[model samples]
Target: MTAEDPTHPDLLQRWNATLLAARAGREGPDPAPYGHNLLARWAEPQRAYHTVDHLRAVLDRVDELVDQGGEGGELELVRLAAWFHDAVYRPDRSENEERSAALAEKALTEAGLTGHEVREVARLVRLTVTHDPAPGDLNGETLCDADLAILATDPDTYRGYAEAVRTEYAFVPDEAFREGRAAVLRQLLSLPRLFRTPYGAAAWEERARENLERELRELTGAS
Candidate 1:
């Protein structure tokens, strides 16, 4: 499927509905404003790769995996986690995932989700920071793979994603950003597996390695 247009009213409504359902029985503050706030955050000028479009891509991947009968049937929680995972992103901070997870816990709890469910969602949101899960961690594996799926896209698309990420960190000096980004690429390349899900491993591993290796070479000015 083609990339989704996050600006579309229908797409917004779809996500809004998901939020509302999370609190089906609860009488609370209007969730609409919360949804609006998330949209506004994603639209911030500093955000290039972490925009609503990225969220949509992740949600789409989740749906595709579910259709494919991948493990872990916790679809609702996974979807909710996807929405909140990057809700608090900031280029300068290392605590974005933690903050985002906390925000998810608060919002989801207020939305009437059970305490256990809310915590699970928060945990899933936090998992993005490492994107590493134990071998049997189906939800974690699936969500992590979906989040990084862009890494395995075709070269032109990967280039667009890489450039967008750089734009988000435009405040960093070129040399600093290059070194930092190259370090990140090297770390990812060193992983035994880039994606944990069976489908993700099959579809993304080789391509993701190729992208990271090439990008690392270019960033470090390697021959």
Candidate 2:
């Protein structure tokens, strides 16, 4: 959704709360401007899957993990990571994650977060490049699981997500897109565990695998 949309206000509020909590009473400039900047980034015209809706979904999934007793380290930091994770997405570019992480480093540092907090947030944002967080990395697991929770959605919803991703890469020819997308699916399927958090594994593992396999088969025309 665009910054002009109704949801913008609520998202800005969420951002404000998360930023304030992360700041821990440290003095900083008004957060509303930073929130606005991020919201506008998420609403960029080139995005289809990585839009404001995706941002909200990731944030919600992070909350779900915590509420369900999963190990979610430093909630406010995790939330900030979620916000910056895809804030600089471009389907055509491979450096999006690195750039997003850098943005988080700069923005969060300026927003009054301590060096440790900013580094953690940037590290979490970069981990999206490979959802496979090392074992026992609670914060990494939480953010990665939440970002990929989309894969465990109901069949129709999963299909819609795939379509949205395709829409983002519309510049790619269909055959090439299918090949690249199938490779991604295969890579994910090859992972020993798609959901690193215990709650995510218990609640979403099977469904996410089924969805990925189904989509892979469709993409490859496999029996």
Candidate 3:
């Protein structure tokens, strides 16, 4: 893998191309055209979470699954879902996935997909609402776990994720913010499992547990 060899198939380049082409032509919607209009609106420079980097991370994971030859037709569906999962992200909104799904639905329609295809894409996007992947949907489960891959990263990477999340909520007061955030992390750790994929489960489970335990210790000053 040389400097220009290009690794990882994160639709980031394709997405940037879409944006660029649209801008160059000045004849269509923004770079990434969603089927729905007027989704959640985040302030400029989404800053930390929900940024292109996070989207790319999720996309990379989806691509990994696809290359590993899993998910079937749901592969592209989940990949597209990853792209638009955070499309309508707003720090102030609770129904982020609902709004993001709207955008994905619109994009699928505009892409000349059938109504069923559009709906499937929308459903995939909705899976990120609470990161609960259904047992029956292997692809959906993969994407959901990928979206939360951050939680299972090594301690140093996980710590960076925690900082990014905290930065996202800079508006909240320190005490309440720490309380709320700690509770959220703890609850996530309480889940019977973190990453749903067999490979991810084997590799990241212990590290995620360690990360969670470390965070909890920091929160209460007791290990």
Candidate 4:
């Protein structure tokens, strides 16, 4: 977890393996043509939001949720959703959900996945946008919460993530970036809890709120 610590090879391998297996296990069938096309593009480095490292971070966060006892029986769907959630990320578009879902549909279908399975993954991926789910829908809530877990990270780390996101949109003016980023931090502070899972909410909620408060104060020169 420390900055100096290297990326763990085992963890990376396991995630890649999981994605491949889950894709291969479906009932309907893999769109081999599209599959070949998508896989080639998936590994290429991108400047904006779809960075490989960001995808890895999301998977790590999702695993953290599972370790903390996220809802059972929906584990694969959550993990698959996490992988595909930002696969087709384009910073300028408001239709990230549909794009990501399209990528998911292509992959799931090629893997012989059925309509119901593809729909489940697509729904979970789309859930990242709404974020708010019924109290009982632990799976959806956990994945969505993990996506925002950066709010609960240490201030310096949170700041780094903020910069990364901004850099992804380097075309934006400095003033615009500052205003937009500050607003996002404020929204997180306004939330009841940044994390929806019981343990994440209980253990990290207070720190996340504090981090957001500090960011807001620094932005407005109030503290």
lDDT of 1 at 101: 94
TM-score of 3: 0.78
Supply the TM-score for candidate 4: 0.80
Please report how far candidate 4 places residue 184 from its true position, in Å: 2.4
Ranking by lDDT: 2, 1, 4, 3
Separately for all candidates shown, the number of backbone clashes (residues 3 or more apart, or on different chains) is 0, 0, 6, 7
Residue runs of model 3 more than 4 Å from their true location after superposition: 1-43, 68-73
CA lDDT, every prediction?
0.84, 0.93, 0.68, 0.70
- Off by more than 4 A, model 4: 1-16, 19-50
Q: TM-score order of candidates, best first?
A: 2, 1, 4, 3
| Candidate 4, position 183, lDDT | 80
C-alpha RMSD between model 2 and the true structure: 1.5
Pick out the ten consecutive residues of candidate 4 with the lowest summed lDDT.
28-37
The sequence of per-residue lDDT tens digits that candidate 2 reaches over residues 155-218 is 9999999999999999999999999999899889999999988899999999999999999989
TM-score, predicted candidate 2 vs. hidden true structure: 0.97
State residue 156's C-alpha deviation in candidate 2, in Å: 0.3
lDDT of 3 by residue, 106-169 (tens): 7656655557766887898887766666666787778887788787787788889988887888
Q: Which wins on TM-score, candidate 3 or candidate 4?
A: 4
lDDT of 1: 0.84
